[model samples]
Target chain A: MKYAFYPGCSLEVNAAAYDLSVKAVAKTLGLELVEVDDWNCCGATEYFSQDELTACAVIARNLALVDPACGQITAPCAACFLNLKKVDRLMSEHPDLDQKINQALAAGGLKYRPGSVQVRHLLEVIYKDVGEEGVKARVKRPLTGLRVAAYYGCQVVRPFKDFDDPEQPTTMDEILKWLGAEVVDYPVKTHCCSGHMTQISEPEAFEMIRRLLYCAQQREADVIACACPMCQLNMDAYQGRVNGFFNTNFNLPILYFTQLLGVAFGLQPRELGFGKELVAAEPVIAAKVGAA
Target chain B: MSVTVKSKRFVDEVIEETPGGHRLRDCIQCGTCGGSCPSGAEMDYTPRKMIALVNAGRREEALSANTMWSCVSCYSCTSRCPHNIPVTDIMYTLKRMAIREGRVKDNDGPALARAFTHYVDKYGRSFEMGLATRYHLLNRPFAAMKMGGMGMAMFLRGRMAFTPSKIRNIGQLQAIINKARELGGAS
Candidate 1:
C-alpha cells in the first residue's frame, strides 16, 4: 500500500523516533510513503484559539498541497491528523466557511475541494490496511514476554469516530497482540495527556501525566506505547517531575507504537529511534525481547 | 444618550464562529462534558456550566473565566456530550473571544499559544527549542532554570533542534495567512 506522508513538525524534532520508526516499519510492511512537497505546519492546537479562520486556512494549505495522484495523505501526529480531518470535514459540511477558506487559499495560487484528499492516521493505515495476517507474516522477532500499554491519548479516536470506538479503542491493543506482546487493558488509555497544558499549567498537566503513569505502573506494563508525539513527550519528559511532585517512585519507558513494531520486524533499535526517549527503552526491551 | 444595540446574541456569535458549533443550542444541560473533562476541576467553570452561562447571556462572566484557557483540547467533552454540542469547539471559540476581548488574565495558556504560533508564523514550522526558550524566559524564568536539565538531556539525545526549519514557499504561506487574517477580520 502507498500513502502520502504528512510527518508534521513534531516528527522533525522531538518525535524523530516516531518518524524513523514509521519509515522503517512502513518499509518492512511494504508500504510506500510519498511526502507532500513544501508542506507547512498544521498550526496544531494553538492556531485555532488565536484565529479560527486563519487556523483553518493554514491547515487547508497542507491539504491543498497533497499531490492529486495520491488521493490519501497520512499524518502520524495526532494533532496534525485531527486538524487535517477536521478542516476537511468542516469545509464539506459548511459551504460558507469553505468559500472563505478557498478565498484565503487562492491568495497562494491554490484551491482545494473539501473531499478531494482522504486524511488518515498512520495507526489506521497499519492496522486496517496491513491487517493482522500481513503483520504476523513479517514478524521475525515476536515480543513474546513484553507487556505494552497501548496509550491512545485522545485525538485519534475522539470528536471523530471514524476508525475505532471513541471510548474503548482496541486497535493498538490488537496490533501489539499480533506482534506477540501482552496488551494491558489500562483504564486511562484513552485519557488526555495534558497536551500543551504542561507548558501552560504544570500542576494540572503533571496530575494528568501522573495518573497515566500510575495506572500503567499499577497494571505492571513493561512499556507504554503511544501514537501521538505530544503524549509521549508529556509522559516521558515530565515523568521525573511527576514523581517529584507526587512523592512516587515510578519509572516507565514511553515509546512510539511504530518503534516496537519495527523491533518485532527485526529492525535495529537505533534505526527505529529507540534511544531518543528520556526514559530508556533499551534495558527494558533487552530484558524482555533479548537485546533488541 | 447613545445606546449600544447588540447585533447578535453572545451564544449565537459563538455558535456562528465555531465549526460545527450550531449544535451549541442543542445542549441538554447533562453535565456530560464536565464529567468527561480530565481537567474539569481546574476549570473555573465546568464546560456544562459555561454553556449554561452562555445560554443565560452572561457573556462577561463566561469570557473572563479561566475555563477555556484551562481546556487541553482533548475533545473528550465534545465526543461525550449527549447532544453532541461540540463542547470543545465552543471552548475554542470562547478562547478566541476571550483573547480578542482582552479578558484573559493571570493565565499562561494565551502566552503559550502566542509563543507557539509565533514560530509557525515566522518559520512555517514550529521550533521546539525556540518556543520553550522564548516562552519560559519571558513568562517563567524560574521554571526555565528548573527545566534546564531536561532541555540539556533533549539536546544530548538529538531530539531538540537549535535551528528552525522553513518551508520552501514561505512567502506563499504568508500570503495565504495574511489574506486569511484580512478576510476573517481577525486582528
Candidate 2:
C-alpha cells in the first residue's frame, strides 16, 4: 500500500527517530511512503492559539501540495495529524472559512479542495491498510516477552472521532499484540502528556507526566510505545525531572511504535533511531529486542 | 448582596471571536470540564467557572485569570463536555484574548508560548534549540542554568539541532501569514 507521507517539522529534528523507524518499518511491511514535496510545519498547538486563519492556512498549503492521486495523506505526528485533519474537517464543515483559507493558499499558487484528501494518522494506516495479521506475518524476531503500554496521547482520538475509540483506543494495543508483545491495559491511555507544558510549567506539567508514567509503571510496562513525537519527548525527556519532583525511581523507555516494529522486524536499533532518546532504551533492547 | 447579571455582550464577543466556540452558550454549567481537567488544582478558575465568568460579563476577571494559561489543550474537556461545548477552544480564545489585552500573568506559560510562536513565525517551523536558548536566556536563565546538564545530554545525543530547517518559498509563507493577519484582524 502507498500513501503521501507528511512528516512535519518534528520528524526532521527532535523526532528523527520516529521518522527513521517509520521509514524502516514501512519498508519492512512493503508500505510505500511518498514524501510530500516541500511540506511546511502544521502550526502545531501553539500557533492556533495565536491566530486561527494563519495556522489553518499553513496546514492547507501542505494539503494542497499532496499528490491528489494518493487521496490519503498519513501524518505520523499526532499534532500534525490533528492539525491537518482539523483544517480539512473545518474547511468542509464551514465553506466561508474554506473560501478565506483558499484565498490565502491562492497567493502561493495553491488551492486545497477540502475533503479531497483523507488525513489519517500513521497508526490508522498501519491498522487499516496493513492489518494486524499482515504485520504479524512479517515479524522476524517477535517481541514475545516485552510488555508495552500504548500511549495514544490526546489529539489522535479526541475532539473528533477518527480511526480509534477516543476514550479507549486499541489500535496501538492490537498492533503490539500482533508483533508478539504483551499489551497492558492502561486506564489513562487517552490521558494528556501536557505536550509543550513541560516547557511552560514544569511543576504543573510534571504532575500530569507523573501520572502517566506512574500508571505505566503500575501496569509494569517494559516500554511506553507512543505514536506522537511530543508525547515521546515529554515522557522520555522529563522522566528525570518527574522522578526528581515526585521522589520516585522510574526509568520508563518511551519509544515510537515503529521503532518497536523495527526491532520485531529484526532491524538494527541505530537504524530505528534508538539511542537518540533521553531515557535509555538499551536495557529494554538488550533484555527484549536483543543487542544493539 | 449585588446581583450577578449575565453579560451577553462579552459572551457574544467571545463566541464571535472563535467559530469553534459557537457552543459556548450551550454550556449547562456542568462541571465535567473542571472535574476532568488534570490541572484543575492549579487553575484560578475552573472551565465551568470561567464560562460562568464569561456569561456573567466578568470580562476583566475572566481574561486576567491564570486558568486559561494552565490549559494544556488536551481536548479532555472539549471531548467530554456534556453540552459538547468546545471548552478547549474557548480556552484558546481566552488565551488569545489574554495575550492581546496584555493580561498575561507573570508565568512561564505565556513566556514559553511566545517563544514558540516567535520561532514558528521566523522559520515557518519551530526551532527547538533556538526556542530553548531564547526562552531560557530571556525568561528564566536560572532554570536554564539548572537544566544545562540535560541540555548537554540532548546535544550529545543529537536530539537538539543547532539550526532550523528552512522551508522553500519562505516569502510565499510570509505573504500568506501577512494576509491571514490582515484578514483575521479585520474581522
Candidate 3:
C-alpha cells in the first residue's frame, strides 16, 4: 500500500512520537508513505473561525501540492485528516467556494480540483487497506495481556462517516484485537478530548480530560491508545493537573495507536518513540506485553 | 414590518455564510445538540438555544454569548442532530460573526485563534511553544506560570521545540493566504 502522507504540524514537534511510530509501523507493514512536498499546516480549527475561505484555501494549497502520481493522501493527525477531507467535500458540494479557493491558489501558481485526491486517515489505511489477515501475519509479539482503550477522538469519525461508524467506531478496536490486545469497549470511546480548549479554558478542558481518564480507569484499561495528537497531549500531559483538580489518583498512559502497532510488529520501543509520552507507556508495555 | 425583516436577515445571513448553514431552517428545537455537546455545561447558551436565538433574530445575544467560544468543535451535536443541522458549523459561523462585530468580550477563544493563526500566516506551520507563550502570557500569565513544570517536562522530552519550522515555499503560501483573505467569504 502507498500514500501521500501529511504529517501536519503537531507531528513535527509535540506529536513526534506519532510521526516516528507511523513511519516505523508503515515500513514494517510494507506500506509506502511518500510525503507531500512543501506541505503547509491544515490550520486546524482556529483558522476556520478567523476566516473560512482563507482556511479552506490554506488547506487546499496542500491538496494542490499532492503529487499527481499519488491520487490518495493520508494524514495521521485527526485534525489534519478532517480539515483535508472536509475542505475537499465542501469544494465538491459548493462550486462557488471551489472557484474562490482556486482563485486563491492561483495566486501561488497552483490549482486543485475538488475530489481530485482521496483523503484517508492512517487508521483507515491500516484497518481497511492492510486488512485483519495482513496485520495478524506480521504480529511477532502479540499483546495478549494488554488492555487498550482505543480513543477515537472527534474529527476522524464524526461529520464524515466515510469508513467507520461515527457513533460507535470499531476500526481501532478491531486493529488492536488483531494484534492480540484486549480492546476496552468503553462508551466514551468516541467522545471529544477538548481540542485547544486546554489553552483557552483550563477548567472546561480538564473536566473533559478527567471524564475520559475516569472512564478508562473505571474500565480497567492498561493504556489509552490515541489516534489524534491533541487527544494524547491533553490526556497524557495534563493528567497530573486533572488529578490535582479532581482529587483523583488516576495514572493512565496515553499512546498513539501506531506506537502499539510498532511494538506488536517487533519494533523497538525507542524506535517507535516510546518514552516521549508524559505518562510513560514503557512500564505498562513492559509489564503487560513483556518488554515491548 | 421592520421586526420581521430583521429576524429574516440574521437567519438568512447565518445560512448563507456557514458551510452547512442552509440546514439552519431544518432545526426542530430539539435539545439533542446541547445534550450531545461535551462542553454544554460550560456554555452560556446551549446550542439548541443558540439556534433558537438565531431563528428568533436574537443575533446580539447569540453572538455575545460564550457558547460558540466554549465549543470544542467535537461535532457530536452535528452528527447526532436528528434534523441533520450542521450545529458545529453554525457555531463557527457565530464565532466569526462575533469576532467581526467585536462582540466576543472576555473570551480567550478568539485571542487563542488569533495567536495560532499569526504563526500559520507567518511560517506556514504552527510554532507550538511560541503560540503557547504568546497566548498564555498575554491572556493568562498566571496560568502560564502554573504550566511551567509541564513545559519543562515537554522540553526535556524533546516534545517542545523552541524554534518554529519554516516551510521551503513560505512566500508562495503567504501569497495564497493573502489572496484568500482578499477574496473573503466562500460565497
Off by over 4 Å in 3: B1-8, B185-187
Interface RMSD of each: 0.7, 1.5, 1.2
* Rank ordering of all candidates by lDDT, starting from the highest: 3, 1, 2
TM-score of chain B of each: 0.95, 0.91, 0.94
Per-prediction DockQ, in order? 0.88, 0.61, 0.78
In model 2 chain A, the worst 10-residue window by lDDT is A283-292
Best by TM-score: 1
Q: Write the per-residue lDDT of candidate 3 for residues A54-157, one digit (tens) a residue.
A: 99999999999998889999999999999999999999999999999999999999999998999999999999999999899999999999999999999989
Poorly placed runs, candidate 1 (over 4 Å): B1-6
Model 1 Cα lDDT, one tens digit per residue, B1-187: 9999978999888888877777878888888899989989998899999999998889999999999998998999988887778888899999999999999879988888899899988999999888878899999999999888899888899889889999999999999999999999987
Tell me the RMSD of model 3 versus the true structure. Answer: 2.1
Q: State in Å the error of residue B133, model 2.
A: 1.7
* lDDT digits (tens) for residues B1-187 of candidate 2: 9999975588888988776677887878879999998879999999999999998889899999999888887888988887888888888888888888878777676677677777776777788888878888888888788678888888888888898888777888877777777778822
Which ten-residue region of model 2 chain B has the weakest summed lDDT? B178-187
What does candidate 2's lDDT look like per residue over A1-292, in tens digits? 8799999888987889999999999998898999988788887888877778888898888899999899999999999999999899989988889999998888777898999999999999999889978898888888888999999989999777758888898999999998999999999999999888777778888888999999999999999999999999889888887888889999999999999999988899899998999999879868876664
Please identify which of the two predictions, 1 or 2, would achieve the higher DockQ against the true structure.
1
How are the candidates ranked when ordered by TM-score, highest leading? 1, 3, 2
**Which lDDT value does model 1 have at B137?**
94
Q: Which model scores highest in DockQ?
A: 1
